[model samples]
Target: MVMKNTESSPDLIDLIFKYIEEEFPEVQDRISELKPTIRKEFSGIETYIRQRSMTDRENQIREVMSLFNGRNATEVARRLNISRATVYRCIKTSAR
Candidate 1:
């Protein structure tokens, strides 16, 4: 499968289907048919990945904030390569 950063867990399944479509064209139709069952069977895995991703993201944000001593969201965003809005959103969400 082509590898890249994914925004959420479901993007992973999309990548897998894309890989299958490219590598095994004959199974493309079958893949669609099995999508629901596959998703159901892997629900736990998806949940785990989602949780881990969120935890990692939160930890990263916290680290960046801590390093900056919570001085500036723009600076943190620059260091973290994320939007200032995202940095603020994370901070706000965590605060609650």
Candidate 2:
């Protein structure tokens, strides 16, 4: 059995498989050879994206700060079209 991204929630994996099934129907039979190679590429990409997400958070903070004349959580939430709690959690978690 090949390992998949541990952090990929089940729904995401399902969606990915759905996409693959649609885009590359040939993978269904030769999954063993395909999964490992794809998994490695995906893992590298996931790492890069995680690193980039941190940079994006800083940019998000800057944009939010500019929009609200400072980092006003509520305004940031409104601008982002997300809940206030989500905005708070994103800012707090991204701090780490």
Candidate 3:
């Protein structure tokens, strides 16, 4: 026997995850206008958070690399607990 979906559209099956979006006020305007399923809103908000986190991490890597006085990439990466590829990429932009 199959259960019927009543809250949402019959054609679409949505997995609604209830969480606190109130804490993130900045995401309000971005997702509020969305007419599609709330799932898409969650995806948009999540993407924003992820991108911001990546940006913050990159900035941190650059700062840490600066304190290294432009030393070996491997050592810097090892100390920072990041990958050699990441360190090498940051080295290009970071002050050598």
Name the regions of candidate 2 deviating beyond 4 angstroms: 1-19, 26-29, 32-71
In candidate 2, what are the lDDT values of residues 5-60, reduced to their tens digit? Answer: 76755644456666787899888776556666766666645332264576776777
Tens digits of lDDT, candidate 1, 1-96: 887655554565677788889999999779978877887888767344353577788787677657555768788888889788888877777678
Stretches off by above 4 angstroms in model 3 are 1-17, 21-55, 69-71
Q: What's the TM-score of every candidate structure?
A: 0.44, 0.39, 0.42
**Better candidate number, 1 or 3, judged by lDDT:** 1
Taking every candidate in turn, the Cα RMSD to the unseen true structure, in Å, is 10.5, 7.9, 8.3
Clash-forming residue pairs, model 2: none
Q: Name the Cα RMSD for model 1.
A: 10.5
lDDT of each: 0.75, 0.65, 0.58
- How many residue pairs clash (N, CA or C atoms closer than 3 angstroms) in each of the candidate models, in the order given? 0, 0, 0
Candidate 3 structure, TM-score to reference = 0.42
**Candidate 2 at residue 81, lDDT?**
78
Candidate 1 vs candidate 2: which has greater TM-score? 1
Q: In terms of TM-score, which candidate is strongest?
A: 1
